[model samples]
Target: MVGDEGRLVGGRYRLVALIGQGGMGRVWRGVDETLNRQVAVKEVLLPDGLPPGDRAQLVRRTLREAEVAAKLGHPGIITVHDVVRDADVPWIVMEYVSGPSLAGLVAQEGRLPWRRVAAIGAQMADALAHAHAAGVVHRDLKPDNVLVQDRRTIITDFGIARVLDGSAGTRLTRTGAVVGTPQFMPPEQIEGGDAAASGDLWSLGATLYAAVEGNVPFDAPSLMPLFHAILAKPLPPPRHAGELGPLLEELLAKDPGKRPTAAALAVRLTALHHPPTLRDPQPPAPPRQIHQRSTVTAPAQPPNAVHPPTRPAASARRRPSTSAAPGGPSRRTLLLAGATVAIGATGGWWAWKSDTKDDAIRAGTSLPGHTKNVYALAYSPNGKSLASASEDNTVRLWNVTAPDGDAEPAELTGLFWALAFSPDGRTLAGGGADGTIHLWNAADRRLVGTLKGHKEQVSSLAFSPDGKTLASGGLDASLRLWSPADRKLLARLDGHDSNVAAVAFGPDGKTLASGSWDNSVRLWSVAGRKSVARFSHANYVSSVAFGPDGGTLASGCWDNSVNLWSVTGREKTATLDGHTSVVRAVAFSPDGRTLASAAEDETVRLWDPVEQNGIAVLSDHSGALCSLAFSPDGKTLASADKAVRLWDLDRQLPAP
Candidate 1:
């Protein structure tokens, strides 16, 4: 038993008020004298008859929880303040969050709006991303652990599941003892297997299902039956009361791999409520028909199709022949048989190709080519030329459209670090490590002039929609605007405290967005050359771009994530987390229907901007991929690493 007092057990923490009580422990809003802050102290009284070894294991589990939670820090995660021993009892001090749990909200309101569920789910996904990155998995993720307050959703008790990470000997119950709450345990977890990140995903699915439908998908009288049902039964889709049918079906898929991750699921939920807003009025291109051809070899057949003579009518059996024909069959018979075989093979090959001709795209078509990592890639507005720059100090221009349609790439080179093409498709501008900006004629591939003024290596380059001004940022922590025609520096804007990694001109060309290594993105007035607003981030910003409508700005960062923000800088619209390494670039499609992101993981991922799900991943690169671009026609996407790759969006897979 514990009491509210200045001293509890041995004066580890002064208890103020009881926050929550669970089956295993009591949480109190307390004051930690050493840390000088209010903290949530969780106290678990040891069972009176507990084995000595089990008590030791519990102590070990408590200590491990402290170690794990201390390493993780994210807005969506509850902070662990400290851990202390009070006589025989152990307690964990966590940041005191004054918020209502999702369970409390559901209990009070009965159900939540789909959009609010999506918003909360997205924040939980971000928290999971952080925990997973730190090699910690939350085995018990429930509505009770989700704190929602002040328009923010936070995931609490991040490391309490360390108890489940214990060795088999440390487990107190039998082999199939009940662990997680039965209603939310995935099929695999119910079979006495260890819980993994996938299990948490299933729990999230169950939680969301409950939130949307106001009931649990599976309910039973006891834990054992619930476990049996989870392991042996298929989850029924949510009741058809409204529009949650499709979303529930996807969430409860039997195979964890088939189920979408939280990040992907959030996007689907978003699309359900807020359909995509198309920027351009043009419709998508008509589907393309692909032609396929093949050649096959045929095996020769015997000229005589007659069956071998059987044993004489079960009476007199004839002996087998002692010797056969010299080459087993006559040459004329072989030639005739071969000709027949060839005819049959030709017919089959033709039929096969004709049947599957509509699908001809091959895997691994994209190839990487730079000596060092590729930093940027862009396709000309006409969609005939592709340009890429790399850390190896070289830029290569590949004729995207070959005259013969099958001709290999033709490379045009310069020592460049970033590349972008003008809106009119007449010129290509490249920023270089040599502190020079080179312009080239897009059609003839002729070098024009170098704009020289920057005193440090350029990191990013972008052109305005009208193609009047080019924005460049570099290691000198300054942004320079240049006039492409005259190759003259228009203005150098300086305010960033660290190197600028990315710069973009807004759709209206009135503002410029620049992201820097100092973990901030600043909106600047292009004409006035002054900062308007600064958006702070937890990690270094790697890339920045404006959405098609120019109302939202998207930034990719070293936090292994991407975020969308409103132009007014009021709130974050969404946070996308899937890349396993640093995200280097983010690009929205011309139609704004898709988003392309390149990361240090050596792959370019295609995301449905409205849906938020990653639809395709191009992974031919063997080195870090640093840039992404889409063709103006929206039929092709280009990704760059050491080499550049062009993916044909028009290509389709064959029907099974």
Candidate 2:
């Protein structure tokens, strides 16, 4: 039986609902509150009336299973976040893969295409190869243990799998108690033989057979007959296998040694999925091919880290998760998570496309257009275009990088409060006061779509560094992530007490910072789709920004102060004081060396992040500065007051 939905186990994992129930244990959809991420928790249930000694032994085995799973670092395998021992029982916490199991999908759709199955087989074989390389062999491999999402296949339930490392290998079966499913077990395994890597391959073959045929290759109504069929019965030919027939036959070969190695099987399956395209037989040189292959395989060499966004480190090595101490600083918490990819997997302050001439930007050069107070401003990823949203019910785009005087900005009518450009600079998203988000094709400036979900007014919007997700915060007190490509709501994040005013994605695209009128600044894991940490503010948080290095987060508050936080320790390292009134906007230069903030006092202040002191103040704006943005190249700054104005940081800030 599963525990109560709200039960908190081990002071970290919170059980929300039972997602899966099996004879061995129960799986619950849960949350890791400290990290504010959703995770799957599997609670191993000791059979009723079991002897105390047996229960202890089972606990040890379960823990060992989790340890083996944790050692596996592959994109195709589910990541183990933590293993908790509660009430003398072990609970395994793992990444929550949101996808249907192969068994479920096959059952729903009545079999799958052989090409699709082959592709999935390739991924699974790769993951299993990784496990075998770690000296761990999964005793039970079946369609039910694999999850499928798009082109991604994730293998789960390692908790029920066996580890074949050293002395542990001797405990394959205690007193002849059989393990593994009958239909998927290899012939040697059915005869009570040790589980080997080849046995897993046999299981994989059986799974593929079922996937394409919608039925197990070998099934019997009784255990004795099932064992007989697995050990002595000839392999059942698959009708729907098509091109996969030869591979499937090789996998189900009775002689384990005759079966293809996991790596070799992956190559063959991948070939079937995508047959070789005719090309020059010589192809590229060996040296160039090696270089290219190295780049691709580097990300999966380590266990998936929760913070794959941490550049260089994610590529160099996999680090253990250093969970924050209760009531202690949460610095390094982001890095502690296993990264899913290498350096390019995520970026810092992201890559900005810039073509602007640093010398062309000048201080106090106003780009006037908005008929009312400009509330938001943003520089396109290329730094060639500038977008401004205002209370005048309009959003305008400017070709700021043009060599000649502005040919005039393109104007779109909408009651907007916040504006952001997709990382590719192809889409312009504007948060409307009418509680909707409007997306425009940047090339033709045509209204492409509208995202409606927020009930109150939408105040802030931002795109993930990858541009795959669009995040918006609104007066509804909720932050929503949308797939701009499909105009579909992906997830809704709720926590703020009042309105959310600002949203920004860190350069790595993993951490998201949002400011709220609730007087709080919250950091979220965009991948995990949950709030990670919160920074308290003295007053309403008006705006938020992240340094390009991803090491620092800044928030402007209504109390006329801007706080610089060290993401490493969740500590406020600096309190920048100079604005006489409320600070409306805060931004960091592309290089992350300088911090910029705008206030209603008609000034934009530049600060030396290293010194934690104000560097210079731009006071030429004729009205209150409501928003601020730095061009991609870090050479220019754009501020919004009654209209948008440019400042050339390259010509340099005013002398302090």
Candidate 3:
């Protein structure tokens, strides 16, 4: 029996409409008037097999699900809005996602194309990457747990997952509850070994195989046979997986160690070409080899005819003649003396060929700029001067030549973490750990004024393209929009539960993006003073930058990956993975041809943003690289570590 609509759930959430029913619970689409938002309310129906006391345990388990889901905040991960009890029934309020499940897609489309499959796989991988970074493991992963809208994918049903290092009381399974989907479970998972990130990878492979092949790799008419096949038989390669190439082999590897990491797989999948075919056939052997004897022999030719000389004979004939007097002219010497005759016979063939020097330059180099670990960097609209913010607490202005040459850098002081130049390169904004935003004349290294309002450390700062509004995020968990001219705070946007780490203005300046340690990135309307979208990540989002086209937003996270989201916030176009540690900063090259990421791994990586492949790694830094900036001319890149280093974009290799 279900409760009436007037009944209040969890003392807060108001039940509205029944949305779905599952084996373990009933779900309702409810409204959280307190938050002024819609949330999915799931009510667990206690199993009849459980005793009165055991029923309490079941309720406790349901509560734990909410606790676990709440910790995993990621765009690709379904958000858990709230958790509470309604009339003694445990309920969880999650972000309401109006999207079709992956199971529905399979039923409707039969099979998805490789590109879509790859795209989905990449998203899932990124979700897992964030979860793993936060020490969480999604024990159960399957098609039904994945949601798709506008062809964008998000992983849901984190009910059975557990946060790594989280308290044991939060674990839901009752010792032998059969936690994962049978078809998708990895061998180690079935054996009850602690599921690691690799288990999720294995499941991703199974899910991807089913999506592209229209059938599970291990399948049968009945459960027993399917179980046997999954445990015994090898998975069949996807028939329609044309140019998936190395990705196919990597995804299906039996040994988890042999499989590519999520970051590596994302890069490989990005290069996949559809409608691929098998390798080319071997060419036929020459006819002369078919008639040859077992023993090898040189072919014979007439003396007057042009013939290829045998190596041994030519060397022997060219050796100094012992028969000739010491230092006297031999047959070879006589041939050299008659070089003019030989040259005439050869028709001057050798004179036409000449060796040429290689002219192509490498990609990714540190450009001249700041003097310390750069915390912020951005290219001006016209892509001329590059501005950098550093731990040295100074903003540096750099002059870059159009083609490529020497770079001259000018410095200003303060331990700044973020820097942005006006669209017209007339003004510069620098934010620091001291909770102040300073404006500067871009043309000269003079301070214009300091804008102050934040009560804590300022982590990020951004300026509207119109240069009228500036947005800043800080440890106060608030976003402030400022009037640069009057140094007045226009609006204080507050919602995040933790420190706000990043902020950016959309191309039109109508929207602003702010990322925080709360593991959420919120999209706000500059005029309406309202949030338009909320994106979650499993870990703190460290940085966000809009692409040159303004159609996409790229976010870097402590998860060590970057995600590209469409403007509508309906889809994640790609997940770029390469950093081995927390990604502290991310920026696009002036032309958007390359994406530069600085990481705690002490390495700055340059990636092909569109292709999602890492093009180069700048490994000279011995400390964490906190920020990166590209010159307006697109020829130089400035990275910050203990000391700022300038990288020549045209130089691909590392410094000696």
Candidate 4:
């Protein structure tokens, strides 16, 4: 049975400090008074409100699982000392190993040298080999579960994950319920099939993938897509692990029968290099600052993928031909991130003077509802709706073509700061001053869900072109990615030194650009889960946008300047300097021929990016423009001040 801190258990063991927690329960650093030595104690947490019968069954299962783990004897496996109970709950005592986890080590060093990763993998594989022979599978293998003590690897929490093994007639979990982290879970586990010895190898591959690449191989943005990727998508080929790509592929084979045996894996891993010699362990190092790229030599050619030769041809398709979710592009239109589409190579913005027959933008529609300043505006992907947020704690959805032209606003407890539409246009998301994002059904204007994590006001929201990921920037100086479908937070990106003002997805959906009040604009490789480049600005960067082709990036800043950049070269290309006040928002026209920026000077300036000169200025608003967006057709532009204004571009073009 478990005891609180400082409480004596089993008449001798005294609980001290909690060292770790997981699905199983909590692991505490304790002392065995009889032996005068420190030990690790796992307190099995029983769920409350369970029926007495089920509670008794769970207790029995916990002891049985602990017995299975206690039988294994290997240096790479943590040694079990004893199992006891105080009040019906079981506490398992284990030999304490003082060191940091492999995950902790990777967090400190970015990524270890390939040679070092191989040595650690070899020791882990050998340990798994011993357990498999003993009929005990470490079903939940991950970087956080593996500890490095005195240069030797120790795999912990074995045989405890499946306390209520379904095969043993236990029903603790519902049928087909997944039990581990999806990033490392194999297809079999996702399918709810029994986890086998080969499943451990797959998770091991994923761990090694993180150790070398600094991210997961699949890393889907949400629940449905993540499950789909594990079941359908081929594993992304490694980029920095030279000569080890094939091994990773073999270990990650979709079919268990196709994977290499643990013995074979051990041979290959040991052949890479000898393990490091034991030394006096120093204090654990601080977690590695993430986003720092490793120094490993990148491959001259794209990393080669090694698919199984016997897999069915049907399994090789990128994505199924199911009809797209509402407002989503066709499956064929979804491009692979690996395909290199050249950005702004030679077509510097072309000059096309407007003819006498051409029309310029003319302000037409005005919508006033907010009692205070409007802070953000966005046009739905289908161009049929507009959403606006304001300091008055409300987000209003507008049916642009409604005969009455008025829609009920969604009220929030906190002031609204940012707004965005999902790629499919069925959902609208708003970021509030409370640091939470609220999602609404655009078609019905009903509340969908709320995502909460950040501690400061959320400042901006952007959806990937594929409609799979949502990126939100906050005044807390952090950026987070979410899956709009199920509201799953995919990743939390931290690097901005000050408030993040804006976020936008590249046309391909593989790259994301974020502008921050820190006076910097950062480019992130979404697939790689790391910031690839950073561009400096003279003052606080307030807004960012990507060109129609994803080749050029634009940023508007408080310095009253708007700058264009080449996404390929990561260098500034041109600067437009006509605004006299803070440039608040920027948007690229659908045709990529013109750029639009809003400013606190109460004007929206159209610029020719290549000429680096202003094309025209629309000064129809009396108040500062806080946000702007171009309709999907590019013929209409929407801007927000204290009120929202719609301008018809085709009717207001300047004549030649």
Which has the greatest lDDT? 2
Residue 411 in model 1: shift from native, Å?
25
Q: Local distance difference test, per candidate?
A: 0.65, 0.73, 0.64, 0.73
Candidates' TM-scores? 0.49, 0.46, 0.44, 0.45
| Higher-scoring candidate on lDDT, 2 or 3 | 2
The 10 consecutive residues of candidate 4 with the worst lDDT sum are 292-301
Candidate 3 segments exceeding 4 Å error: 1-7, 45-47, 51-58, 159-179, 245-249, 271-656
After superposition of all CA atoms, the RMSD between model 4 and the true structure is: 23.9
lDDT score for candidate 2 against the true structure: 0.73
How much is 241 displaced in model 2, in angstroms?
A: 80
TM-score of 4: 0.45
lDDT of 4 by residue, 299-374 (tens): 0111113211112123121211111235542211111221111111111211222233323322335676766557
Q: Which stretches of candidate 1 lie over 4 Å from their true place?
A: 1-5, 9-12, 45-48, 164-177, 240-247, 262-382, 385-656
TM-score leaderboard ranking: 1, 2, 4, 3
User: Model 1 residue 373 lDDT?
Assistant: 55
Ranking by lDDT: 2, 4, 1, 3
**Structural RMSD, model 3:** 21.4
lDDT of each residue in 1-656, candidate 3, tens digit only? 25656456767787888877765567788888788788888776654455666567667766876687689877788888777876676777788889888878999989888877887887777677556545567766878788898746888767544421122432324343434467887766555466677777788888888888887777677656766776677778679866553466566666767665554344235323121212236355333221111110111111312212212211111111011234542221112211111111111111111113221211222344344445666666676566666655556665443333234455577666677776667888887655778888877767889988865557788889788888988765678999888889899997875567788898789988888877778888889999888876767788888877877778887666667677774456666554556677888876787677887766676655555544445555556667777766666566666555555454332221
Task: State candidate 2's TM-score.
Answer: 0.46
Q: Per-residue lDDT of 1-656 in model 2, one digit per residue for the tens?
A: 44488999999999999988764578899999999999999887654555787667767877888887887767788999888899998888999988999999998999999988998998898687667656768777898889998779999876465632112323434334444567898888767577788999999999999999899988999878988888788888899999799789999999998887675466347445642222225434333110011110111111323212212112122122111235532211112111111222111111111223343444345676676678888888888888888766777887786542262455698668789999899999988866789999988888999999986567799999889999999865689999999999999988886568899988898899899867799998887888889988766688999988898888888666777787767767766666656688999888787788887666777666665655455655546667898889888788876767776556333233
